[model samples]
Target chain A: MPCQILPPYLLEKIAACERPEMAHAATAARRSLVHDAPLRRLGDRSLATDQPSPVPRIADPAMPVESGPAPTVDRTVSDAEGSENLPGKIVRTEGGPVTADSAVTEAYDGLGDTWRLYWEAYGRNSVDGRGLPLDATVHYGQDYDNAFWNGRRMVFGDGDGQLFNRFTISPSVVGHELTHGVTQYTANLVYQGQSGALNESVSDVFGALVEQFARGQRANEASWLIGEGLFTAQVHGVALRSMKAPGTAYDDPVLGKDPQPADMAGFVTTDSDAGGVHLNSGIPNHAFYLAASTLGGYAWEAAGQIWYDTLTGGLAATSDFAAFAQATARAAEARFGGSSAEHAAVLGAWKTVGVLPG
Target chain B: MKVYVSRVGGVAGIRLTWQVRVDDQPDADSWWRLLEDLPWQSAPSGPVQPDRFCYEIKAEPHEAVIAENELDGPWRELVDRVQRADTDSR
Candidate 1:
């Protein structure tokens, strides 16, 4: 699934508004809709037919073909240069000198940070957990206010600079997009309804974790905001989504309010956004935040480990919120004793989010 | 006749609508001919792929909702023209 960082509802809000300040946002939203519609259709066809994603897998030109225990971070960053074409021109590779383009440098560093987080924390390789060379394209389109993983590689857009900055400015944004590939290889969660929301939540979980791990921030110390720096001063938003407080992340005259519901009672019943995958993900995201905060230490150690385990530990592709909660509880108990604080915290967190019975 | 085309679905779940009066179109007869030839009445209804688009077409007394991939021939052309019209207006 090619999951985008910004949801369509926000774009629609901007497009429908008549505010003079939002004219650029409206144009950007319209252009993004037009460009993304066909690409999304193509992605759906591949998924429906079980054909490989239209995004071809490109091997790293820098890395040699060798089979060993070498934990190498093979990252290749390309420049789209304001065009929609992807993997445009290879601007920087792993071990290469930094380019003058800040987007390229930020993308390269972000990919490396994500790789280090997974490698050092979970011993997992790249996205596929098998040393799949990381590839990213920066400056993907003309003020295209979104970043996505097209099943094979990451693509970042230079934002309109009013409501959004460059997509690569936030490492969690990069992690969030790349983690879709992780979900693709792991549970391969069906990207619709409750299961789809779980898929989105899992990405957010690791995305925040990746940022936390890179910054050495404890759960309490972390901001718990995804895409923190991606938003400009004009947006009147802290970030794109807040794991700590999902619905409170953003509320602007142009972008409207973040529509994420933090609990089951608020679960949106919508026929769009893959059944509100981005909207309903707030429930589970809040759950993770509660668990991590309650555990009161480095999140990537215990809470992050449990979520990672549940994700890779034979979770069903169609697992709903309750099923996912139960899986995480079981994983916590398996990793820690049933009487351990980790298990109790995991169960308590789910209950707090109304996914599990208290 | 005024034709309204609205697209729903895709990753963001946003609905995009474009309205154009067919009578004002440069190729009004061709547009009507294409619209009439589409299999609008028989379009299936059920779960579609997460990112695939579903289009709702409305022209006064006639309306139909069709999935993007299922659309072919004249329906595709109608959609293309409507999208182009919307883009041009923007």
Candidate 2:
């Protein structure tokens, strides 16, 4: 699946609006849907052929592997220049001077930050854990309302000024999309039904953690919001999805209420959105927030580590919420001892979210 | 006659539906001609790609659901026209 930061349900609400003032939003939503459809099809064909690995392996000859000591952070940011074409003009390369375009600079920096969090916190090199050079394309399409990682690289949209700002405006959004690459390389989670929801939840967890790590904030101090500043002042919302409080992220007249359900009780059962990957993700998202906050201190230290281990530790592609919950509990037990608070917290979190028995 | 074109499948899994009355459109005859000859019952059978789209096109009496890539010739033209017309109207 093409990992889009903005959920489709939100766009559907915007598209369905009858208000005269919402015409711009409606048009943008429809355009975004039309634009993203083929990209998803492209992603499917790519994944079917290529089996990615953590260890460095020659996949594409065009992207030559760097010799000598492994490069820590090799990033390339491109400018789409308001067209749909990806990896457009190479505006900035690794260790190069900052670009005048804030989106370009932000994409460059956000890639580094995500890399730092993964490498520093979990000892993973990059998205593929083998120092895979991060590449991003910003300013994609005219008034495009979404951002996504299309298997190989990150693509950001210049949002319709009516609702969203530049997608790269939020570092966690960058982290979130990049983490989709991480999920792709590791779990290879089937982006459908429960497994897909788990895939989205895992990205949200790391997205929030990457921000927390960058700001040097403990779990208690972190905002726990994904795409926090992506919304414009005109929109009545703090962020796209709230880890701390899922369904309460946004409730605007034009955008409608946030449809996320924070527990299994409210789990959305539908064939849409790959079985509500973004919607039902709130259940596992809330569980992660609970685990991290309950464990206290730097979330990356224990909570993040546990989740990281669960992700990279041979997680099945088709694993569901219960399976993921059990894996995290196991990871916590393994990392911090069976009797440790981290293990108890992990188990308690799943129980609280109704993913596990109380 | 009214034509309802809905696109489903994508990472978000949300469906987009656009309804257009044939008489209201400038290309009404073109739409009617295209729909008349379309293989309404012959949908491509296979697993849907992770985030790819499949379209369900209903033009009153006839309906067809075709895969994103499977769309061809007049069917593609009709879908494109309806989507463009909807966006233009908005």
Interface residue Cα RMSD of candidate 1 after superposition:
4.4
What is the DockQ for all candidates, taken in turn? 0.17, 0.21
Model 2 has a DockQ score of 0.21
Per-residue alpha-carbon lDDT of candidate 1 for residues A1-358, written as tens digits (9 for 90 to 100): 1234567777668756657677546544543443344355455656687643454321222222454565879999998889978779999988999888999999999999898777666657799888899999999877666777877788888876866789899988888888888888888899889998898888889989889877767799999998888878987788878889888887877667778888888989986556778889999999999999999877887788788878888899999999999989887766554666989999999999899977
Chain B TM-score per candidate, please: 0.83, 0.85
By TM-score, who's the top model here?
Answer: 2
Best by lDDT: 1
lDDT of 2 at B56: 78
* Runs with alpha carbons beyond 4 Å of true place in candidate 1: A1-70, B1-90
Q: Considering summed lDDT, which 10 consecutive residues are worst modelled in model 2 chain A?
A: A55-64
Q: What is the lDDT of candidate 2?
A: 0.77
lDDT of 2 by residue, A268-334 (tens): 8986555677788899999999988997876766788778878888789999999999988877655
Off-target runs (Cα >4 Å) in candidate 2 are: A1-70, B1-18, B33-84, B87-90
